[model samples]
Every structure is written in structure tokens, then in C-alpha cells.
Target: DAVYNILIDRWTKSSTPIHCIAHSLNPWYYSKEWINDVSGRVSPHKDMELSEERNKCLRRYFPDVKERRLVNQEFDRFSGGLDAFGSFDSLEDRWVLDPKAWWLVHGSSAPILQNLALKLLGQPCSSSCCERNWSTYSFIHSMRRNKISPKRAEDLVFLHTNLRLLSRNDADYKQRESKLWDIGGDAFDSFDNGAGVLEIASLSHDEPTMETMLFTDDED
Candidate 1:
């Protein structure tokens, strides 16, 4: 409870109206008061009113007059009844559906909010996946085979990563491979004929060295 209070205090201090608006769109958090405590730290109704005010401020800069009108109409619909915007009868069911997909399919009445939800919800909060991809790139473009052209290296990396992702399911893997072959039959044939040996050599050297294993604490 002490840690939660500290965290919430920091979060509330740093938070903007945009953050509040995003939280309001999320079904799970929609019913939650701005501050979920009995103590008078924040007023939930006042916070909601502020969020709506911020939303209005955000809408003022719309360059397109037609879009502005559409947004206002959507807001009217949303204010009238939250349930009127989506097909789902219950918020519980909406919680199970992908938030972006739900907004895209069901937010026709609230186009501006839908677009905002899609943008906000789809944002990546961390660069961990990008860092991992860079690690993979280092393995693919090792010091020895650094002669590989940037374009060819990119294509190889794309194929390698996507093929690995598809490998879990045999049928899907084969289907994707067949589709790739159909699209770039000549390129694949050329790669097989010319770069097969070079690729194998690259993969051989790409294996983790003893030092790498020691640093990573990997026994195998």
C-alpha cells in the first residue's frame, strides 16, 4: 500500500489530460475513479470533467472543417450513451476483444475517439524489441561477412526473422514459404545458387563463443 501510494502520487503529478483521456477509453479502467481511494486525494467527477475539457482543446486544431464536425457529432453520440457507440452489450465482453480492433469495428459513431484510442493504445512504451532486433542484426551482419550489401542484408534478416516466427506451425510455415517463393522465385533461386555457401558460413560463425556463453550464464 505504501509503494502503491508513492507510485500513484508520482503518476498523478506527471499525468496530463491526454493520459486521462486514454484511460477513459479503456473499458477496464473506465469505471475506476481517478484516484481509487476513500481519502480525498482527487475527485473522480472533476477529473472526468477536466478530461472532457482537454479533449475539446485537442479538437480545436483540426484543419479539416468536415472532420471537426464529424468529431463533434461523434462526441455528442458518446456523451449521449457510451453503449450506443459499440456493438457489445457488456463492457466485460469488450475487455476480451483487442482494444484497437474493437474501436475500429465498433466506434463508427465515435470516429475521433476511435482514432485516438487506436493511436494511444498501439503506442510502444519500450524499445526492448528494437534492441533485440539490433542484436539479431549484429549476428546476421557479423564482422567476418561485413561485405554483404545493406539491401541484401536487410532482405536476409527479414526472411530469417519472419520464417522463424512462422516455424511453430508446420502448415503455416510451408504456406508462407510457398507464397514467398511464388513472389520472388528468381531471387530465392539466385540466393540458393550463389549465396548458399556464404550464408552457411555466416551462420556457422554466428554461434555464440565461449566468452559470450560465460557472460550470458548459459551452460550450453
Candidate 2:
């Protein structure tokens, strides 16, 4: 009972209307096999909490009454297995494809809901990515480098983050025996190879910098 209480507390704190809406739109929750395997519960559409949270999300996402009504209509069609959503191919693909891809293929009938689904479903449910960015930022602006200007630190963090991302996709990174990519350690550790940091820093000037693209809107 203690464990159940803890779980419920955590869930109550973390769960939001967006999370509820995402779960409501997820195809797997509607699968008989999945539903039976888990709780043998009613359909997600029938879940009172999910239904209420979905309505909350609808109000927040569509302030215009007409747009909200259209979205609600589309939601009804989706939940009821009407029209395109009712087809065999759509249900079959639900089991085979990921949420975003499934929506892309079958979501044409409900463009507004599809757009919302794509945006919400594509999001990560955790703060780990943001934490990693802050970790990188901290490493760059540590006591030893406290003199670094905010703009310079920001640029460095951007470069470091993108470099790690790019390297993970590189053929050489994939073939490495260690396979533990970040084993090199933190704070631009991946570049500890024979390649000098200064050499890579020089390349940033040669191409379009992240500063131009990331902060352009702020400049306006």
C-alpha cells in the first residue's frame, strides 16, 4: 500500500492534460490485446479522467470556439472508428508503426487533430534532455572558466551539444569497439581525440553559426 501511495503521488504530480491527451490519442491503448494484457479496462475514450483531460487540452489548444468544435468533431470521428479511422489498414498499421508515423499515414482526415497529435506525441516525457543541456552548460562555465562571457558560453554549449549528436550518427562512432560513446567523459570530451579543440573551434567561424539561427527571432 505504501508503494501504491508513492506511485499515485508521483503520477498525480507529473500527469497533465497534455499527457492525458497524448495517451487518449495513442493507438496502442485502443488495442484489445494490449488492453486485455494490461488492465482489461474500458477503452481510453471511456476513461473519465482521460476524457476530461482531453477536453481540457482541447480548450487550451483551440481558443476559437469554431476551431474547438471542429477538433471535437474530428475527435469523435477518431474515437468512434468512423470513416478513414475505421479502415482495416489504419487499425493494422496502428500495431505496426510508431505513434508519429501512424498519425502521418492515417491522420489526413483530421488535419487539426493530426497536427496536435504530431506535436504532442513527438515530445519526450522526461526532463533528461534539458538536464543534459544544463550539465553541458555548467561544465562550460565552471569555476576555472568563470571568466567566459554568457554569449561565448552559450555558443560553446551549442557547439558541444551538436558535435556529440553528430558524432553519434557518424559511421566511425557506430563502429567503435567501446560503443559507449560518452565514455570519453563530459564537457566536449568526445573531441579529446588526436584532433585539437582549437582546430574544431576554427571551423565554427567558417560555417553558419548556431547563434544566427537560434537567436534570430529574439533579435526582432
Candidate 3:
């Protein structure tokens, strides 16, 4: 309790309590056990309050009977048996595994909670990616492209980002390559060579280069 208070005091002084709680909700770094411990020590009603807040948040998004029932069903599954998810005997292994993937596989019985967990756990702790995405949007919807409709611009950005993400995944890349090959042999060969070069370049350095050092200095 003393340690918890100390940490909470430090965090509160440096940042908002809500931000700290949100950060703690991230399952990749902290699990339910951690939440229970912190909340238990922080305040007797902390857990209940947090649960109520989460319920309210969900309700705001989904107020219909069907969605509410789904949420209730998910809660029932969770409360009925932790074993419903899987054996938590290997805590270290579970921690190392992606929380999103784990929830998808194990929480299939609780679809609503599975979806909720994925959404929460997948949230980045920082806004850097969002800022970069805005930069992408600006580049895509530049002065010359100002005439583009909002819907068209949105579609273009979505396709550009998602395609780049898909290309990073090996299975998706292979599938895309196969489709490209069917379209044209020369094009496929050119794509394969370019991809190979990029892969080699990405793997070329384990240590920081002079350029990286300069970038770090600039950031500092």
C-alpha cells in the first residue's frame, strides 16, 4: 500500500490519474492481477468505480438491447470462470504473448469482451503514430489535391496505410506477390528484387549508424 501510494503520488504529480489508469489498463505490460493489486491498495471502491466507468463508456457506444446483452454475457463468462479463457499457469509465457491474439483465441466464447479487450489493448500509449498519420494525410491532401472530396481523400489514406501495413505481414506479402506474378512475370520479378533489397537494407544494421546518431542529436 505504501509503495502504491508513493507511485500514485509520483504519477499524479507528473501526469493525470486518468492517464495513469489508462496506461495500467494496457494488458501487454500489466495484467488483471496488477490492476487488482493497485486498485485494492489505492481505494476500497476503486475497482468498482473503474468497472462502472468502463460499463458507462461501453453503454455510450452501444445502448441497444442486443449489444447490452452481449456485454452482459461477456461479463458472465469472465466471472463464471477465469479458466474459460485458458490456463494461466504460465504467467511469463502469457505476458510475452500478444494480448490481442490471446484474447481472440481464448475469449471466443465472450465475443464482446474479446473485441473490447482487443480495442483497448491495441491502443498505443503515445500519440506519435496519430501525429505521423496526420502528416501522411497532409502529404496526400496537399494544395494540388485540395479539390479532392473528403470521402475520396479518406479512402485514399485508408488504402495507402492499410496496403503498407499488409505488405509488412509475410503472409499478405506472399499472397500479393503470387497475385502479381499471375498478372505479369516481369513485374513480379521486379517487385521481388525490390522487396529483397529493402529486406536486406532493413537487416543490415544491429547497431546505430552515424545517421541515427545525428537524428538522435537533432531530436534531443
Candidate 4:
């Protein structure tokens, strides 16, 4: 119970109105089995916090009062499973397809809400991916390389990030014989040198010898 309470508190702090809106738009939340599977969790319509946040998001996105009202009316139909949303195909497809794809299929009836749902549902729920990009930025713009101009640093980071992304799709990235893949390490540029042999070789000239560093101990 304590662990659950901590997790719930953390989630509440991290969650935004967009998260609530995404939850409200997802069809699985309306499922009886899904609701029952998670204690204290309810459909968006029945969840006061979720409904409030959903309304807040709606107002922010659809600032026009009349347009917001239209979206809300459409939301009612969606939540109630009325009209096109209630069709056997859509109801069955709720579990069969991804949320964004499901919206793409049956969302023509509520075009406004559909567009909002597609955008919100497609977003990443966390900043981990962005943090990774920042990690690469830090590596490129390190203290040792502080003399590099911001524009040059930005360009290098962009080039490095895109290259890493493109390289992942190459066949050699996964081939053991190619030795191009980086299983794990502190260094991020290992992919350029097979098994990082070239990196180790380069570091030997500029930095302390690996053997001496490993064997030496500091007395504090």
C-alpha cells in the first residue's frame, strides 16, 4: 500500500492535462474489464480528475467557445459509444488496433476531436528520449571542447544524432562479424570504430595509459 501510494503520488506529480486528455481519448479506458483490472481506476467520464483535466486541455486547444462545445458534444458520443463509435467494427477494433490508428479509422465522425486525439496519443509520455539527445549534446559540447562555437556544437550534435539514428537501421549494426554494434559503455562514439579499438588506440596518445590508471590508487 505504501509503495502504491508513492507511485500514485509520483504519477500525479508527473502527469499533465495532456496525459489526462490522452487517457480520455483512448477506448481501452472505457472497457469494463480494463477498469476492473486496476483498482480505483475508472472511465474518463466517471473520473472527476480526468474529466476536469480533459476539459482544461480542451479549452486550451480549442479556445473558441462554440468549437469547444462541439468537441464536447462529440466527446459525449465517443464516451457513450454512440453513432459511428458504437459500430461493431469500431468496438471490436478498440482492442485490435493501436489507439492512434483506431482514431484514424473511425474518427471522421468527430474530426475536431480526432485530430486532437491523434496528436496527443502519438506523443511520448516521458522525457527519456529527449534526455538521451541532451546526453549526446553534453558529450559533443564538453568542457574540454568549450572553445567550439554554439552553432558549431549544435550542428555537430545534430549530425551525430542523425547518424546514430540512421546507422541503427544498417545490417552491419546487428552483425557480430561486423563488430560495429556497441553493447554498452560510457563512450557514445564506439559505433564508428569496430569494437572501439580505434578509440582505445587514440586515447593512448592523449590520456593516461589505461594500465597505469587501472593500477594507480589515490590516497585521500
Candidate 5:
């Protein structure tokens, strides 16, 4: 978040509402890194998982990311040990991460850190507004595996993200909808309603529910 504030202080200029809003929704650093009294220390290197020092310089290959710092050696080493070197232990890394899978989704970064940065990134404190509906978001992914055609997978995820994964119910829809309006006004507001059509919505306080009309042109 500190980095977000620093960057926003210099890069972002608009204050008329649209460009002024931030939208960051991910884990933080201190929280995840502070496990079992470790207090932000890297996971203990058991020396048992040191398959080998084979992945020592994966970061050197990172294109835009500079040689910021060293990495942990004991963590999982799937993608050529990409994570074995990052310092998700720091708040700065959470605020401005690149296009890597684990960092945004998993990694050690905490929610508080990313939440703070989301404020500075001018985005929102949400991951809900990120998607659309549920039923239409059909994909064949499983924790057991994720193998599918790139094209169909893209469409499924696209549907999943814009229609389902982001917000599948009501209260979330409203909250995210408001944030969208803050960023892009009616344009974005009309695009995502958890339902295809725009209309009045309501839900119970406990659940993320909303009532909207579903359509089927074939019925005509």
C-alpha cells in the first residue's frame, strides 16, 4: 500500500471520480508471512525439500521486475521455482505485482496489505465486481487438473470472471456495481448486473442475493 500511495501520488491525476477510484483485491504480506510466530520470516528451510539449489536465479529472467531482493528456498518449486525468490514478506511487493499467477491468487501476501493498496490503486475493496453470473460460467476445471482447449478455456474463464467468479449473488452485485459506476459510470454499470438485463435488485441481509429478470429469446 505504501508503494500504491507513492505511485498514485505521482502517476494518477484525475480527481473527478472516474480515474480517482482504486481497485485492488488480493492478499497482503504481513499477515501471510507471519505464520507460527515467524513474524514475517520466510518459511523455515527444512533442508529436506532442497531438491537441489537448481532454481537459484529465476528472478534474473524476469523482464520488467528489477533485482529487488532474494527469495525463499524451501517453498514449492513448480514453475522453475519462480516463487522460491520473491519477497512477498514485504508490503511493497503486494501493492505492485506483475502478471504472475500465484502472487495474485495465492502466494504469501495478505488481505490487509492488498486492501490498503487497492485504495491507492484507485480500484476497490472487492473481488466480486470482477465477475458476472454463475450458471452461464460453465468450465471443466477441477482441483485435480486444469486441462482444456485454450480458446474454450478462455471463453469459459471470460464467462466465469465477468459472469460468475466475480459475483454470483445480490449484495455483492450491488457493492461491485456501485464501484463500477464510480470508475466508469453508466458504461460499466450497464455491462455487469449478475444478470444480462438492467433492473431493480434486492436481497436478504445475510446472503448475496438479488432479483433480476432472466431472458430467453427462443421463447418468442
Candidate 6:
């Protein structure tokens, strides 16, 4: 019901919290160990495949793992917010705030926002200010043919992701928001008994829905 509520009924919210939900993709959170940590029963749902997805998302996010991991890990260290969205929980576990949030947005974009909130925080913050400096730094560090020291590389990506998120000043943010609106309707009218159907389904796992991840954190 988590995915059902999210992709269906709850998607009607006024503000979508797609901030830095990158951490939700963290393989560790979906690992058998983490599942066991959060609940006693093992789930076939998020199993080992999460590691592959984590690596893929990270690769799209940064040029190098050592470089990417350094900055991402560091950013999270100073703040554990960004990793918030990618959780098995519909929302955080705070008393007052969590209850209210669960009552409202709940599983909606809660995790995504949590991730972005953490990534966005800094000594000083304003949506407009962070990205410019960050991009310049990334551009400089990622010069045509030079490898940045891991520390320096991290500093650069951290600044970029934090200060000037990839969509800073650009409408790419809105553009992306617009794109996701039609994810399900992109191709044909519906799935049918065709050979290609089998091939496509093989290409990806079952589409996630509320039922897909419905077990409580304790039930997992």
C-alpha cells in the first residue's frame, strides 16, 4: 500500500518533495541485514538488487565512485538528512512531527524531501545562493583532463549538490517534474499477451506499488 498510496492517491499533493532522495537508493538500507535490523522477517522485495541500483544511481550522479562516495558520505556525516527519503519507512519516526507528517504527506515525497533537506543544509542556506558556487567548483575540478584529489573532488560535488543542486537556476527542475507526470503512459495503451511483453518485464522487476512495500517497518 505504500507505493499504491504514493503513486496513486497521495501524488495529488500541492508540493512534491523530490529534493535529494538519493540515499533511499542506498543498497545497505535494502540489504537483508538492514531489513533484519528493521524487522525480523526477510523480504524478497528489496533484496540484493538494491546494491546494483545504488551503484547505478551513484554512477549517474558522479564520475567516480571513490570521488562520489567521499563527498556523498561526507555530506551525510555532517547531516543525516539526505538519506532520509530512501527508507523503508513512510516517514521519519519523530513524535510530533512524524505523526503530523504521516497524517498529511506521509509516504508521498517525504523520503525524497528528507534526502534533499539534509543535502541542502549548510552553514548558511537560501535556495538561490548555493548552486552557483557549487557548479563553478565542479567545473574547475572536472577540467577536461585531470583527476581531482579525492578530498577535493568530494568538496566540489558536495558543494554542487548542496549549494547549487544540478537544477539550480535552470527550469530543468520543472522540466524533470513535468517529465515524470507521464511515466506510465509513455508507450502503449496497455500490456498484452505478446512476446515483447515478456522481454520488457524481464528487463525490469515488478512495478512497485503500495502493496509492493506494504509491510510495516516492524513487519519487514
Misplaced by over 4 Å in model 1 are 1-21, 32-62, 76-108, 122-128, 146-152, 165-220
TM per candidate: 0.45, 0.69, 0.44, 0.68, 0.20, 0.22
lDDT (Cα, tens digit) per residue for candidate 6, span 161-217: 564333334555334544212222243233355322432342233334412322232
Worst 10 residues of 3 by lDDT: 198-207
Pick out the ten consecutive residues of candidate 2 with the lowest summed lDDT.
Answer: 180-189
lDDT score, residue 218, model 5? 19
lDDT of 5: 0.35
Give the whole-model CA lDDT for all candidates, comma-separated. Answer: 0.56, 0.76, 0.54, 0.76, 0.35, 0.40
lDDT of 2 by residue, 7-52 (tens): 9999997578988999988877776666677664877799998899
Error of 5 at 91 (Å): 17
Q: Write the per-residue lDDT of candidate 3 for residues 1-220, one digit (tens) a residue.
A: 9999999998657454343333333344444554455544532123565556555655765789798888766655454334553457324334566766666656677776677667767675555457557866997999998999889888988987787656544454335445322212344344246333332233324224523642454479
Regarding lDDT, does 2 or 5 come out ahead?
Answer: 2
Kindly state the number of residue pairs that clash in model 2.
Answer: 0
How many clashes (backbone atoms < 3 Å, residues ≥3 apart in a chain or on different chains) does model 3 have? 0
**Is 1 or 5 the stronger prediction by TM-score?**
1
Report the C-alpha displacement of residue 19, candidate 1, in angstroms.
5.5
Alpha-carbon runs more than 4 Å astray in model 3: 1-46, 79-83, 86-96, 136-220
Go through the candidates in order and give the clash count of each.
Answer: 0, 0, 0, 0, 22, 15
- Residue 31's lDDT within candidate 2 is 62
Best to worst by TM-score, what's the order? 2, 4, 1, 3, 6, 5
Worst 10 residues of 4 by lDDT: 211-220
Among these predicted structures, which one has the highest TM-score? 2
- What TM-score quantifies how close candidate 2 is to the native fold? 0.69
